[model samples]
Target chain A: MPVLEVDHLSKDFGKGRVVDDISFHVEAGEIVGLLGPNGAGKSTTIHMLLGFIDPTAGTIRIFGKSLRRNREDIFARLNMASPYAGFPNRLTVFENLMIYARLYGVAERAAKIRNLLGRLGIEELETKQMLELSFGEIARVRLAKAFLNDPQLLLLDEALGGLDPYAATLAKDVLTQLQREHGTAILYTSHNMVDVEEMCSRVIFLRRGRIIAMGGPTEVTRAILREDRKKPALSEAFIHASRGEPHAVE
Target chain B: MRLNRIAAVIERHVYDAKHNLERVTDTLYWPVMDIIVWGFLTLFLARHGNLRPGLISFLLGAAILWGMFRAFQRDLAVSFLAEVWSHNVIGLLATPLTLREYLSGLLAINLLKAIVGTAAAALVALLFYSYDFFPYLIALLPFIFVLMIFGLAVGILVTGLIVRYTTKIQSFTWSITGLIMPFSCVFYPVSALPGWMQPLALALPTTQAFEGLRQVVAGGGFSWERLWAGLALDGVYLLAAVASFDALFRSARVRGLLVRIE
Candidate 1:
C-alpha cells in the first residue's frame, strides 16, 4: 500500500477553483516532486494533505486510512517543514525541539533530539534562541523538527528555499539518507530544478491545479522537448507549461 | 486530551516568559501600578474625610477583582495571539495536538498569569492601604471562578474572530474586554445603570460577582443566590463561546485562512 494517497482532490474558494481534480500517490521510500508556478495550487494542495484545509471534493488516505477519520492517528506518523511557519522566537533551539518531540510522543526524546542535531550538524545551535539564529540556521532547525518524530511520510514545501548552498546540500543529503534508511516517503515541492533533478525519483508537474505531466526527470524533459522544441532547460519547460501553453506532450 | 501534549504547549509559553524579560515585566507592571494607584487614591479619600468608612476597602477590593478579570482575559487572548504573532499556529496545528489540548494549554497559561497578577495586586493593596483581602478570600472563590469563566468565554470568541478574519480584526483580541466593561458593571451596582440598561448589566456574570463582593464587604454574608446566578450565566456563555469557536475553526479550515493568516 502507498504511504500517501490523494484521490481526485479539489479545492474551490467559491470565486474560483484553486485545486482541480488532482490525484497522486506516494509509495514508501519514494521521493515525489510537486512542481508548479505561483498560484498553481501547490501550497493549497499541501495544506489539504496536512488537513489544515478541508478539500471541497475527493479524499486523502495516509497509511491506508481516511485522513478525515483518522487525522490524529495519521498525523502522528506524518510531519511537514516549510519556510512559511516556524518555532517560537523566544525559545532556544533545543527547547523548541523538545516541545515538539513531546507533542509527537517520541520516547527517549533527549537522545533523539541529540541524534537529529548531530545528523543536521546543528549541535552548536542548541542553546541559541530562534531569534538569534540566521535564516539558514533557522531553516536547519525546522528541518530537524520535521525529523523529530521519525515520520513515515513527510511533506516539504519549499523547505530548502532560504538555506545557503551548503546547508541545502546537507538537508538534501539528510533527507536522502532518511528515505534510504527508513523507507520514508516524501512529497516535495520546489522551483529549483537542480535539486529536483538531483533528488526526486518521479516528478509531477501542476498547472492551474491540475497535473499536466508525470514521469521520470529524463522522460518529462524528453516529453517537454518533443512538444516545444525551442525550450531546452527544464526550467524553461516549467515556464511554458505554467503559461497554459499547449506544449505538455505527456 | 493528552496531558503531555498540553504541558508541552504550556512549556513553550513558560520558556518565552523566562527568556523574554519584557514579557515578565509586561505581565507584572500593569497590575502593580493599578493596585498602587487605586490604593493611594482610596487612602487619600479616607484621610480627607471625603469618603465613607471602609470606602478604601471597597475601592481596593473592586480594583483587585477587576484586575483579576482583566488579567485572566488578557492572558487567555494573548496566548492565542502569541501563536499568530510568532507564525507558529500552522506549525503547532500540524502536529498531533488536538484543539482541546491547545485550548487547555492556553487555559493553563492563563491560570499562571492570573495567580501572579492577583498576588501582586493583593500584596500591593495590603502594603499601601493596609486592606486585608484575605478575610474575604473564601467568599471570593466562586466570584473569581465565574469571572475567569466569563473572561475565557470572551477570549475564545475573540480568538475565533481573529483567526477567521486574520489580521484585519486582530485588534479585537486586545480590546474586547474593554468593549464589554460598560455592560459588566465591574465598578458599580447594576442598579446604578439607567433603567433601560439594567437588564443588560444584570445579564453579565461580572455584575453578579461585583454585587456579591459588595454584599460581603458590607457586613452581609456571602450571597449564594448571586453566586449561583453568575455561575449559571457563565455556563451558558461558555457553551456559546465553544460553539462559536468550533464553527469559526471549521470556517477557517474551509477558507484556507489558518495557513494564510500570518
Candidate 2:
C-alpha cells in the first residue's frame, strides 16, 4: 500500500482556486519531487498534507486511514521539514529535538537526538541556541528534527532551501540513505532542480495549481527536452515547464 | 490525552521560559510588583486609623489572591502567544499531540507558574509588610480556587481569539483583564460598584468569590451559595470557552489563518 494517497485535492482561497483538483500518492521508499514556480500552490498542498490547513475538497488517506478522521494518529506516522517552521529561538539544538522526541514518545531521546545531529554532520551544533546559529545551521537542525521521529512518510517543503551546497549535498545523501534503509517515503519540493533530479526517482510538476507532468524523472524531462537531448539537465526543461508550456506524461 | 506528550510540551515551554527574560518578567516580576504596590497602598490607608477593622487584611489578602489569578490567566495567554511568536505552531499541532493534550500541557505550565508566583508574592508580602498571606489563603482556599478557574475561562476564550485572528488580537490578553477587574470587585465589595454596574458585578464568578472572601474574613462564616454559584458559572464558562476555541481552531485551519506570524 502507498504510504500516502491524495485524491482530487482542491483548495479555494476567496474566489480563486489555489490548489485545483489534484491526485497523487507516494509508495514506500519512493521519492517524488513536487515542482513548480512560486504561487503554484505547492506550499498550500504541503500545508494541507501537514494538517496545518484543511482542504476544501477531496480525501487524503495515510497508512490506510482517512486523514480527516485520523489526523492525530496519522501525524504520528509522518513528519515534515520546512524552512518556514522553526524552534524557539532561545532553545539549544538538543533541547529543541529532545522536546520533539518526547512529544513523539521516542525512547532514549538524548541518544536519538545526538545520533541524528551526527547523521546530519552537525553533532557539534547540539549545544548552540537557534539565535546563535546561522541560517544554514538552522536548516540542518530542522532536518535533524524531521528525521528524529523515524517517520514512515517524510515531506520536504523546500526544507533544504537555506543550506549551502556542501550541506545540502550531505543532507541529501543522509535523506537518500534514510529512504533506502528504512523505506521511508518522501514527497519533496525544491527550487534546485539539480538536487531534485539527482534525488527524486519520480517527479510531479505543478503549474498554476495543476499537475502538468508526472512520471519517472527521465521520461518527463525528455517530454520537454524534445529538441535538445544533449542538455539532459532537468533545470533547462523546468524553465520551459514553468513558463506555462507544459508537456504531460504517464 | 497522552501524559508523555503533555509532559513534553510542558518541558518545552519551561525551557523556553528559562532562556526568555520577558517570560521571567511576566511570571515573577509583574506579580511581585502588583503585591508591592498594593501592599504599600494598604499600609498608607491603615496609618490614617480610620480604616475599617480587618480592612488591611482584606486589601493585602485580595492583592495576593488577585496576583495569583492574574498570573495564571496571563501565563496561559502568553504561552499560546509564545507558540504563535516562534512560529512553532506547526512543530506542535502537526505532531501526534492531540489538541486536548496540547491544551493540557499549557494548563500544566500555567498552573505551575501560578503556584510559584503565588508563593513568591506571599513571601514578599511577609518580608516587606509582615503580612501573612498564606493563612488568609488557607482560610479562603475554596473561594480563591473558584476565582482562578474563572480566570482560566477568560484566558481560554482569549487564546481562542488568538488562534482565529493570530496576534492581531493579542491586545485582549492584558487589556481584557484590566477591563474586567472593576466588575470583579477585587479591591472593594460588589456594592462599591455603581448601582447600574452592580448587576454586572454580581454575575461575575470573581465578584462572588471576592465577596465570599470578605464575608469569611468579617466573621460572617462561609458562603456556600457563592462557592456553588462560582463553580457552576466556571463550568458553563469553561465549557463555552473550550467549545468556542475548538470551533475557532477548526475555522483557522480551514481559513489558512495559522499560515504566518510565526
- The lDDT leader among the candidates is 1
> Could you tell me the C-alpha RMSD of candidate 2 in Å?
1.7
- The CAPRI-style docking tier of model 1 reads high
Q: In model 2 chain B, where is the ten-residue run with the lowest total lDDT?
A: B131-140
Can you give the DockQ of every candidate in the order shown? 0.80, 0.79
Q: Model 1, range A1-250, lDDT digits (tens) per residue? A: 7998889999999889999998889999999899889998999999999888989999888999987778788889999998878778888999999999999999998899988888888899899889999988988998999998878899999988888888888899899988988889999999999889888888888888888777777666666555534322568668777667775534
Model 2, position A10: C-alpha lDDT score: 96
On residues B1-262, what C-alpha lDDT tens digit does candidate 1 reach at each position? 8898998988888998988887677578878888898877877787898988766777788888888888788778778888888889989888889988988998988788888888888987787678889888998888988898999898899888888888788777768778878887776778888999999888899988988998888888899999999999999999999999989989999999999886
Fnat (0 to 1) per candidate: 0.88, 0.85
As for candidate 1, its clashing pairs are: none
Best model per TM-score: 2
